[model samples]
Each structure stands twice: as structure tokens, then as C-alpha cells.
Target: MNQPEILQLFRVEEKRSKSSLRQLFAVVWAQLKMMLAYKSWLVMDLLSTLASVVMYYFVGLQVDPHQLSRSGWGTSYLAFSLVGVATSNYLWACLTRLSHSIQHEIRGGTLETIAVTPINMLMFFIGLTARGYLVSLIYLVGVFTVGVYGLGAKLSFTPQSLFVFIILFVLMLVSNQALGLVAAGIIMVYKRGDPLVFILAAVNEFLAGVLYPLELLKRFPALQVLSMLFPYTYALDGMRRVLILGASVFDVNVLTDILVLGVFSMLLVPLGLKMLGWGYDRIRREGTTSSY
Candidate 1:
């Protein structure tokens, strides 16, 4: 190539090197250093997760097979609970991780320092939790594998089912992450966050039917109505239909679940980002951005 062409190529490559995505990846790598610092964490996490799966499997044995079919879900309570255990990690990965990241900055008195950087704080905050979400995705796949191979939990793997699942999974990430941004914002302002996060995570899992069928909520009309308010309710229900029942995208129930989840993602994501920005500003104004 000519000298001019080589210099132009260099310039283009330099610009691309500084692109937002590359910056985000750089930040993710940095965040991973902290996450991987505790070398045994992954092992402990795997062991605990396996123990929980085994425990729930035995629990499923005690549940009458008729009870699941009567509820209009699948016949295997083991399969049902395994799905719940797998998908429910998203709640913590999304909500708790973001909040904890903010608090970590606060505890270290670096929140304000980082906030002042030319870096995009909003994107940076989201990037900080990227590793956690990635880890959660791994767990989700791991549990699904364990369910299929280790425990013989029946799951549908047809193209139609997987397509619907991929769509719902994206919607679930976006919709559920909306509240996580808001929770991180709350932590930014309060310097305390886990109590609120804990309450929401617990209640969200329960309302979303993470461990039980939504049919049980029929007994509590008020709670049934409340359950419909969370995006994860639609997500979990849709996921179950596709994964456990091998439902098609054309199925009315699956369509509704995907539709509702998409709507939730559209409405909540922007609102959550706005709330996070608001909280970040509030802390700065109060001179408490780095105070824990």
C-alpha cells in the first residue's frame, strides 16, 4: 500500500480502537479482575448451585405429578423447579450486581472521582455489571444442561422452541435490567442498597413463579394481580412454555407473553436509565457521591 493509504488506515484503526464498544470491553475486563479475585468463588458457586438443584429435585419427588398437570404446566415438578432455579439468577445478576457495584465505589470513596471522568458514567455503570450478567448466562446454561443430562429433565430443543426462547431471553434481560438501573441509582443516592434489593429480589422471584406455578396465586386474587405487574412474570411463564412444553411462537399464550415482555422492556428501560441519571446527579449535588 502507499504511505498515504497506510496512514489513513492507521487513523481509521485508531478511531475504531476508541469506539464505545471497545471502551466497554476494556471496562468489562477491568471489572472481571475484581470478580475473579476470589479464585475459589466460581467453584463454591458451582457446588452450592449443584446442591440446590439436587435438593429441589428431591423436593420435586414429594410433589404429586397430578398437581403439575392440574395446574396446566408440565408433568415433572423436577423440570419445573429446575427452570425456575436457572432463570431466577437473572434477578440477582441484574439488580443486585448493579447496586453492589455502586456501593463498592462509594465504600472506596471513588464514586465522585469516576463520575467526573470523560467516560460515559451511564454506560460505565452498565458495563460494570456485564461480567455478572455473563456469569448468570453461564449458570442458566449449566442448569439447563444439568437438568437435561444429569437429572433427565425433559426439555424441548426444536428450532421453533429455541427461537421463541431466544426472543424471550433478550426481552427478559432488557426488561429485568430496567429495574436494576433504578436500584443502582437508589444505591448511589442512599449509600445503602442491599436491603431494598433483597426485598425486591425475593418478592420478584416469588411473584414471577420462580419456584412454583402461577396457578397457586389464583388463591390470592390481589397477589395474582400484583404478579402481572412485573415483566419477569411474563418472561418466566413464556420461557417455561417454550422450554418445557416446546411451545411455538404462533401459540397465543407465547405470543402474549413475548408481547407483554417487549412492552415492559420498552417502557421500563428508558425510565430506569433516567432514574439512574437522576440519582447520580442528586448525589453530586449533595456532595455525597463518594460517601458510603
Candidate 2:
């Protein structure tokens, strides 16, 4: 290509990049403003977190710590349950945020605008969720603090444990984000709520050991097999090992969880994008983009 042509192309690319950035910032700012406007939720968020910690702490006092230790879930029942509750809550927020965002946009009659806008849809979703997840993250930190300090729950904060926790947490988010994409696509086409969100929540709560030991599921052979179908099972197990046992991601037991999440992300993410595009195009083709 000629030097002038290359320079013109570079200028066009620069403008496009700037425009995309502007679009992203606008979405993030709008969400932030809404959060600031409805400030009552901020107070409720921390208050509810504290309540959960206190409730669980008392409940933990009634449980036999040795039964928990036998399952390798640590002797402190409070920490075990807090990690599960916090992980499940944060993950649920991440997993449903996208579909909820879509439903809100549809109600506001902005789905059509999003469909036609010349913006990066991926970045659009990222911008859509960034602010909300930031708040959820802050809530998670509070839950951990109250559980560890206020309620006397035990947690190991070694570098190895932190590394595994970070890996599991990120993988957990990535894998769940795909489910959110699929759920959002379903909402877009059906003009209804995402059943997948609730279905997964129910499954995770019962089978992922969010508040119980996975070893206890052995009594129900069929349910034990069913639990293996969900990635949260591994993620939660890995998290418990990291937080309670201070295990590294590279450790044999934890490595299995890492691999499971890695595979889930590799498969689900691409499939989710394709599914969302198909669903969105189908809705737009039917002239129902804003018909929530």
C-alpha cells in the first residue's frame, strides 16, 4: 500500500478505537450513575452480608467440626460455609447480570439501539457488567472480612492459596459468563425471563456443596453423579481446598479443578457467542428486538 493510504487507514482505525472506547465509557458511566442514584442498596448490601455471617456463625456453633474435617472441608464450619456462600453469591451475580441487563434494556426499548449500534458487542457486555460486578466484588470482600474477623472463621491467606483462589475465581467467572450469554440470548428471543439462571442456581446450591460437604453426597449415588455435571462442583471444591487447606493450583487435587474449568471455558465461551449471535439476529429478524 502507498504511504498516504496507510496513513489514512491508520487515522480511520484510531478514530474507530476512540469511538469504541467512548461507547464503553458511556455504558459504564450510565450504570454507575444509576447505582449512585439508588444508594439505599449499598447499605442493604453490607447489612445483608453481615446478617448472613452472623446467622451462619451461630449455625456453625451447633455443628460438629470433626464431621467437616473428615471430608477435608476444614475444622471451622464458619469459614467453610462463608467461602461457599460468598463464592456462590458472587458467581450468581456474574452469571445473571448479562441476562438481567438485556431484560432491562428491552424494557427500556433500547435493545434495537444496541443491535444497530456500530459498537463492539463484546465490549458492550463488558461495559454492561463491569460496574455491577465491581459492587458485587466489594460485597464479597466485606463478607470475607466479617466471616474471618468478626465471626471467628478461619482462612489461610498464603500466596499459594491466593494464586489458586484467583485462578478458580477467574475461571469461575469466565465459565459462568458464557451461561449468562446463553441466558441473555434466550431472553432476547423469547421475550421472557431466563430459566437457566434459576435452574443453575438450584443445581449449584444442592450439588455444588455450597453449604455442605461434597462427600456427604455419596449416600445418593445418582445425585453424586449429577453434581459432577456442573463446573461449580469443581470450582467450589478447589476454592475450599485453597482457602481451608491452603492448597496451590498446581497441587494434584486442585489441578483437576483447574483443568475442568479451563476446558469449560474453552468450549462454552465460543459456543455462547455463536448462540447469542444467532438468537439476537433471529429476534431482530422477527422485528421483536424491543418486545420484552
Candidate 3:
């Protein structure tokens, strides 16, 4: 082949390789545009985040610092609760956004059309959920910033600690995606709200230590056992230790958390995919793919 012809061929191949990424970006951009169209909701979301920070700050103040340290987190209650709050936001996004997106597509009569497209179905759902996950990360950062500056919450992070924190955060996201897929699958087949999502949310709030330390749950063995089943319990605890306590990834407890989260991701990802495919097939067969 001529030099110019070879160059042209390579360009085409590059474009083909990037097609999936382009599609993913398109999905995220569409969601962002839709969100921006409702300027009021965006503003209200920010205000609500601020309100949460204020409420949590005051509540944390009521808890003695000595008692917070005694809980084994080695930080003030405000700082510890900040991490829990931030992590829980991502969990909420995962639990609701994927299922809601599917419901929205069905009610809008676009589910069938999209299902017929050549793009990967899993990637499409991932892209849809990615927008909400990104927004939740923004909310997390905003809340933490407000806590540090406005609420007098101390957040100390060295470069090493920050690196460990990012690794754990990514693992948490992958682990949470499994739960999102299961929720999405439930929504697809049922064509109605999934009670599991609400149940999980309540369980996470009360049992997963979003607002308090899981150490308290140790007193109640049943509740502690239930909390252990949800990966967020470990995630929030590990994150607080690494970020606030300056623990290393190799620390015994931190390493255990990583191993557990990694195992959950490996097991759940395939199971989630299988369940989603089964659910989609059932809906298609029942002629309800586009039904709300």
C-alpha cells in the first residue's frame, strides 16, 4: 500500500476502535443536557447538599471526640461521618439511577428502539449510570469541601493516603455496579418499581453505618452480620481509616477490605450480567420491552 493509503487505513481503524467510547460519551452528554435543562433542580440539589452538611456537622458536634476516637476510626465524628456521607451518596446513585433510567426509557417508548441498536447493551446501561455516578462524586466533593471549610471538620491526606483512597474508591464503584445491574434487571422484567432498591437503601442507612460507626453494630450480632453482607459497610470503614487515619493499603484491616471488595466485584459482575440478560429476554418475549 502507498504511504498515504496506509495512513488513511490506520485512521479508519482508530475511529472504529473508539466507536464504543464515542457512544458512551454521547449517552453521558445526553443525560447531562437533560439535567441542565432543568436549572431549578440542579440548584436545589446543591442546596440540599449544603443542608445535609450543616445537619451532619451539628449532629457530629454532639458526639464527644474522645468517644469518636474510641470507636477506632481515630478521627472526630464530623470527619468520620463526612466520609460515610460521601460514600453513601454513590451507593444511592447506584441503587436508583440505573433502574430509573430503564424505567424512563420504557415509559418514553425508546427501550425497544435502543435494544435493536448495534451498540452493546451493557455499555449503554453503564454509560447511563456513569452520568449519575459522576454527579454523585461531585456531590461527595462538595459535601467534603463544605465540611472542611464551613463545619470545621479536619481532613488530612498525604499523597500516599490519597492514592490508597482512590484505589478503594474505584473498587467500591465496581462492586456497587453489580448491585446496580441487579436493580436494573428487576426493573426491566417487572415494569414497576423494585422494592429491593428501597430495602437496600434503608438497610444501608441504618445498618451500614452511614451516619454512625459500625462498631456500634457489633453489640448486635444479627445486625452486624447483616451489615457485613453489604460491601458498603467495609468500603466506608476502609475509606475513613485511609483518608482520615492515614492508614496504608497494606494495613491488615485495609487489606482485608480490599480483598473482600475485589472478591465481591469478581463474583457479582458476571452474575449481574446474566441476570440482566435473562430479564431483558423475558421482557422481549412478553412484548413488554417498551412498557412502563
Top of the candidates by TM-score: 1
Question: Candidate 2: misplaced stretches above 4 Å?
Answer: 1-22
- When sorted by TM-score, best at the front, the candidate numbers are 1, 3, 2
Q: What TM-score, computed on C-alpha atoms, does each candidate reach?
A: 0.91, 0.90, 0.90
lDDT, model 2, position 130: 74
The parts of candidate 1 lying over 4 Å away from their true place are 1-18
Q: For model 3, which pairs clash?
A: none
Model 3, C-alpha of 145: deviation from truth (Å): 1.0
lDDT of 1 at 2: 98
Question: How high is the lDDT of residue 270 in model 1?
Answer: 93
lDDT of 1 by residue, 156-205 (tens): 88888888989998898898889998888887887767899888988999
Model 2 RMSD vs true structure: 6.4
lDDT of each: 0.85, 0.82, 0.83
1 or 3, greater by lDDT: 1
Residues 1-292 of candidate 3: C-alpha lDDT, one tens digit per residue: 8999988986783333338788788888888888789889888998998899888888876887777778887658788888888778898887788888888898899989988877767778888897688779779988988988888887767788888888888888888778888878878998776677878777876787888778887789999998889877778777888978888988998899888889989998898888788888899999998877
**In candidate 2, what residue range of length 10 has the lowest lDDT sum?**
10-19
Residue pairs with backbone overlap in model 2? none
- Model 3 bad stretches (over 4 Å): 1-18
